[model samples]
Target: MASRRHPLATFFHLFFRVSAILTYLCCDWFSSSFVGCFVTVLLLLSLDFWSVKNVTGRVLAGLRWWNQIDEDGKSHWIFEARKVPASNMAATEAEARIFWLGLIICPMIWIVFFFSTLFSLKLKWLALVIAGISLQAANLYGYILCKMGGDGDISRVTSSFLPQTVFQTACPDDFQKPGLEGLEIHQH
Candidate 1:
């Protein structure tokens, strides 16, 4: 069941890892929220890939995935996995762009929010909340940018998480979200 691992998750794990490390060299205050995103990305990378050989091992693997793996070890009891060609350069670049954006944007937003407190406590709460919300938006933009082919990945993740289809059904990317810099998921 080599199906559970998502390419995006693995990629993001590396990203968050590097970003967390860079938090020391590149910036200051590697805060709890930073750790939270790092941990979430790590958990995603630990998705149970079911490349088992024995029946017992297979069962154990399936059990680890909450019985998500099939007897044939295909699905691995995780979310639907799309097996894009390992050589898909375009998709790879698209994913990199999104991930890099998150790597850059997430920390910057957190840093600003982290320092917004010297002025006032209310600003601290406001900054942290705004930073968290921005992380969600950054995640959505990166995910959608990664998903931008065959009307599948970008639109699908966008619709699932920060879905704008309900409010801006007519917009191509539903890129009309009020607060976003630009809801347009600019594909690489």
Candidate 2:
């Protein structure tokens, strides 16, 4: 069965995505906007939001599928030029190259960035490092918040989308609690 969309969650997702991009580009006043965007994207990417739960489920499912593979066989993947179509072979090769390159180069890229930051004596680079550290901290906070549920979010402090109505004041019944001593409610 498919999950029903929560109206509030949908609104926040759209708001966050657009806010993140704007935060990155709106550096006219404060340069910290870029840092905010970095944190937001990192959090959004890592968090298993409803939109991404399928992706997480697929990953877990894929791992389970892989475990079923027979590891005892002496096997090799031989791509026959005659059997496979040229376009498909080319596409497969391109995707394979990308996967292999990501596997090899991502760590190296991080290592290079690490050493460059570590050995650098420049003030500008140090500022960038500080921004990155702030982003990581924000991401960690976001993940913790996600785990705890979205009833409370630090984004509400920075976001303009938070509810600010005085309807509860006008309609007091919505805000009032019933007396538990005399209360007996139907459990439907």
What lDDT score belongs to each candidate, Candidate 1 first? Answer: 0.36, 0.33
Full-model lDDT, candidate 1: 0.36
Clashing pairs in 2: none
Q: Candidate 2 regions off by >4 Å?
A: 1-30, 33-41, 44-90, 121-188
Which pairs clash in model 1?
1-50, 68-77, 69-76, 69-77, 147-153, 147-154
Error of 2 at 45 (Å): 6.3
lDDT tens readout by residue for model 2, 1-188: 22322334333433433343344334335655555645554454234233222222112111000112247864332111112234343323333222223222323433444457678753344443344334433432332233223224457532421121123223434553222222111111
What are the per-residue Cα lDDT tens digits for candidate 1 across 7-97? 6454443444344334423332445575554454333322211121111111211111122456777643121113334444333333433
Model 1 alpha-carbon drift over 4 Å, by segment:
1-87, 122-188
